[model samples]
Target: MSEKRDMSRSRKLFITDKLMRLLLVGAASTSVLVVCLIFLFLFREAGPFALNPGLGKLLDSQWIPVSFQEEHFGVGPLLAGSALVTALAMLVTVPISVLVSIYIAEIAHPTEREFLKPFIEILASIPSVVLGFFGLLVVAPLIKTTFGLSTGLTALTGALLLSLMAIPTIISLSEDALVSVPYALKNASLALGASHLQTIFRVTLPAALPGIVAAVMLGIGRVIGETMAVLMVTGNSAILTASPLSSVRTMTATIAAEMGEVPFGSVHYQALFWIGIILLVITFFLNIIAQRVLKKYGMMK
Candidate 1:
């Protein structure tokens, strides 16, 4: 009787485990399906412009989609603007985030780490719109006054705000990666008479390099996708310029600022979808690269 009872209990547990596994698989599969569906929908809507966009139209500096004379769908300015802002944001964010991460992971006391971690997380939780408001009201004026510019709204303004948003993500992920470095490696470095700083730069950082790369890539993704803040502060200009101080319009800002006014199924509307496709592709690549780095580091299977 006892043997039969144990066997029955084991069988029930096995069935429960199998059910849970199936549920998990289903959830993952659903997520993948949803992503593919989104790609299909975007491509379907943007197909007309995306498939046969004229050479000059796509590469033109102007982006006047509402003009009565000629509706241009050039994305050169938008792409350039996105790239400029993202580059500046990454420049400001990556180094500071990595340094802060190293300090939190290796140098800070446990109490300091505890306080800092939550504070960084809180920064990450702040809404983008609020940051946009802050940028418009505060940072914009400061930049104008300090730089002696005619207006405060420029790619630099957007980059500054986006950097603020990207920093928390970079710091948190990078700190985790640094923390995950094996203690044995650190100990061995110390046994070889390496100083703490030396050990960190030579051994710990190298071990955590993959995670750091992932962190930077994810931060780039955050900066690239930001809309409200960039729209509010970038002056919404579609000018093609390499200067960070110039007013610019990012792809995200373009979509946010114009999507509502565009008639549904219009060429302008479809052009917006094309922009979405571009953004989706950029973000997808960033995620793929980050995942590859993580997998290489054994952080993912």
Candidate 2:
């Protein structure tokens, strides 16, 4: 009788497990379906403009879209500016983020770390619009005076603001990764007479490289997708420029600024969809690379 009861209980538990798995799969399928639908909608809207003869015009630096007259759909300059902003922002963010992470995870005293971590979290929660406004009022003027640019809304200003926005993400992720490093490794290094710094550099950091890389990837994505803050500070000039001081417009800003003005079913409108597709592709690529790096790190350990 006891054996029969045990078998019945086991059967019930197995059925419950199968039901849970089915529910999880159903949720995942719904998410995938939603993403597919969005992509399909964007492609449908953007396809006509992408196929137009004037689509070649999008390669030019100047963006002048007229509703009645022949429309110019040049997105190249905007795309280039966006890339430059994200790249420069990363350059600025990476060093500071790594250092901050080091301080938070490995170096700081317990009391200080507790205090600092909350402040950092608070910084992360501040609205991007507030930052943007601050940049416009304070940073832009300072930049204008220092650089002697007529307008403060330049690529450098945008990049600076973006770096500020990205730093918290990098710091948070890197700190978590650093904290996950095995305690045994640190003790072993110390047992051999290595200093804390030596152990961190030689052991902890290398072990946490996957997490750091993932943080950077996430930072890049945030910078690339940012719209309002960049739009407010970037002078909104669609120009291809290698000069950091020059005024520029990023792809996200362009879409935000122009979408309402462009007529529906027009080539100009569809070109915006092309820009969306480009962003989608870039984000997808970064996520894939980040996932692979994380997987490699997991397997290595």
Candidate 1: segments with Cα more than 4 A from true spot? 1-25, 50-56
| Candidate number achieving the greatest TM-score relative to the actual structure | 1
Best by lDDT: 1
Q: Any runs in candidate 2 off by more than 4 Å, and if so which?
A: 1-25, 54-57, 67-70, 299-301
- How well is each residue in 123-181 modelled by candidate 2, as lDDT tens digits? 77889899999999999999999988789999999999999899988999889889888
Candidate 1, residues 1-301: lDDT per residue as tens digits?
9999999999999999999999999998998999999999998887776556543466666788988798888888899999999999999999899999999999999999889899988888899999999999999999999999999999999999999999999998888898899899999999999999999999999899999999899999989999999999999999889998989999999999999998888788888898898899999999999999999879763
Q: Candidate 1: TM-score?
A: 0.90
As a whole number from 0 to 100, the lDDT of residue 140 in candidate 2 is 97
TM-score of each: 0.90, 0.88
Per-model lDDT: 0.91, 0.88
Per-residue error for 202 in candidate 1, Å, reads 1.9
For all predictions, the C-alpha RMSD in Å is 3.2, 3.7
